[model samples]
Target: MSDEDSRPVHIRRRGLDPADELLAAGPLTRVATGSGADAGSQWMATTHAVVRQVMGDHRRFSTRRRWDRRDEVGGEGVFRPRELVGNLMDYDPPEHTRLRQKLTPGFTLRKMRRLQPRIEQIVAERLDAMARAGSPADLVEFVADEVPGAVLCELVGVPRDDRAMFMQLCHGHLDASRSQRRRAAAGEAFSRYLLAMIARERKDPGEGLIGAVVAEYGDEATDEELRGFCVQVMLAGDDNISGMIGLGVLALLRHPEQIAAFRGDERTAQRAVDELIRYLTVTYAPTPRIAMEDVTIGDQVIRKGESVLCSLPAANRDPALVPDPDRLDVTREPVPHVAFGHGVHHCLGAALARLELCTVYTALWQRFPTLRLAEPAQENRFRLTTPAYGLTSLPVAW
Candidate 1:
């Protein structure tokens, strides 16, 4: 398919043309998908200023609307349940504050540093397994997707034997190509698992993030609340890391100088990871906030209960954000971007994710310096209509 024809589904769903003056047109514009869910027209913030503004003002804008996934998508949906919404992203103010206070310790820089050696070990082991599998390998299956899945299993205290089932549930939840019924079923099953595990944790609070939350919060938090947070963390990590790894590799290969730098040392790899995250803007989070009342955004008044969507990619790519926004230069100095979002809802797993990406990008190329894409970038199927965007599979060779 032509690049024009194969534009990201989110852009299409929002009814915006890529060639249009996205920034010059204005910060806030209205777009409607064909679906009846948004027949009235939904507001989209397409520039850095407006997106960051909408995200920063939580009092005027609310995330309660994010609960209904299918409705928000104008039909397309994921497995995460609005009913089980206890994550920091799903709440505002005091409720979000309480939850974040308890969960932040588990995601602190100290913990991420401690987890670095293990991540390196996992990346190396996965690369070794990929080597054994020989040429023309599927990077998504062998490395990109599997690495995060395995890491998530450990981070959430899932047993080694259950990683396969866990990944299946995650894939079913976020893989946009899957039928809505299947995705919903996966979400339901994960909730069930979390509930049972929450019950067990209430009794013992074993180890790892979930367990630590259970131990730390105790009677302060309910089973439902705890389960919701865990589910959010797992789903968020599963999709985001996989996408970054897959897309980051493709970006690096397209810029061999960057690839060489990424493979050089830890500092270079960290720089490469940040640049990739900024360029890819994979999460596209901080979208879809509902106005609490008369929310004035950039001279436009969004009346009560109006839907607001922030275009993270457009925001990240804004020329005002940085010079030459389209170029991918790993050596460039890191600039603030909305990839992890902004404000109180910034990604909790940012530290750990950086560790993972830094470790994998550097080590993978170290293990296979001759690695190259086995298929054209366009030939690879992308997971569209999902909350987070990424490849379905990346065929590669060394």
Candidate 2:
């Protein structure tokens, strides 16, 4: 359980909890190299405070990969791959600021609220399908996997008929178990799909988020930015919510008392949703941050050009973050956690994520009051290979 253990942090979870070593690690530790873009060793920020510092101080810890030594050999190396253009996570302050500003209006509280009715409808449709599929259904196939994508389809104005194809690309690209070439292929296809959507929005915009951005930003928003926004939305919105739903439901099944609390009043459900997000911390790390200059954190001095990967799950589980950090207390007073990340690059769709989580958790249980795992939790499959921690299939019965 030494902090210096160089295991890949993303796969460190033992079910819904962060691996003990990750939680036990000091503020910063060295992670083995193969997991990051950097050719040398990468450092991990495990404590809540240190992780916050690494993510928040973009000046010192740059998200742009070229800032790292790995990309430094190439000339002026700021050239982004086709996939990264307008990717807010890959840009620093001014560029990130520009893209984020243009997209901010689409994710504001009011905008997320505007999308709620459609979200609820999508959830209900998935639930109805689950009912038709009958008991012992895989919640992942029946509900978890379908809802987020369908909702996002509605959000991005993906033609209702095309959502299945869109979801396939998302799954293929995110499956880390797949070969790099295959994943890259999926990513290329996904980008092409977004580009087509962006083109359509240019002429006659629709009511979806993509169209709204196109209409509002007009020629000001480049197709690349619009595509980037779509890519980010589908990437973040689909898998994270799907993972949370599957894992969150599994966590609740084991802790039945928490479900009772989660099924309580509106305010209680919202708190439970937030606590689940923190406890599960499904999207493991944000993009690895590279140091632009020497920086001191605790006893460690990260020299310029070293890569730092902040462990979101580890940081959330750090005792410094809350009492009995590993315990899931849905009723605990909301404590700020980095599940949605921190700083200016914090998740743009966080509000939308919360609304979806609250709606899904509350409504699903309402529809199936007796829901329980079809098998023991320990025997269930955890998706260790994906970027997000989730169940490969969550078999449940009412």
TM-score of each candidate? 0.88, 0.93
* Backbone clash pairs in model 2 (N, Cα, C under 3 Å; residues 3+ apart or in different chains), count: 0
Kindly report which residue stretches of model 2 are placed more than 4 angstroms away from their true locations once superposed: 1-7, 35-39, 67-77
Q: Could you tell me which residue pairs clash in candidate 2?
A: none
For model 2, what is the error of residue 23's alpha carbon versus the real structure, in angstroms, after optimal superposition? 1.3
Winning model by lDDT: 2
Off by over 4 Å in 1: 1-9, 12-25, 66-82
Question: Over the stretch 194-250, how does candidate 2's per-residue lDDT look in tens digits?
Answer: 888888888899888878887788877799888877887888888889899999999
Tens-place lDDT digits, model 1, residues 250-315: 777767776877656778778778888888877754547888778776679998878888888778
**Candidate 1 weakest ten by summed lDDT:** 10-19
Model 1 vs. true fold: TM: 0.88
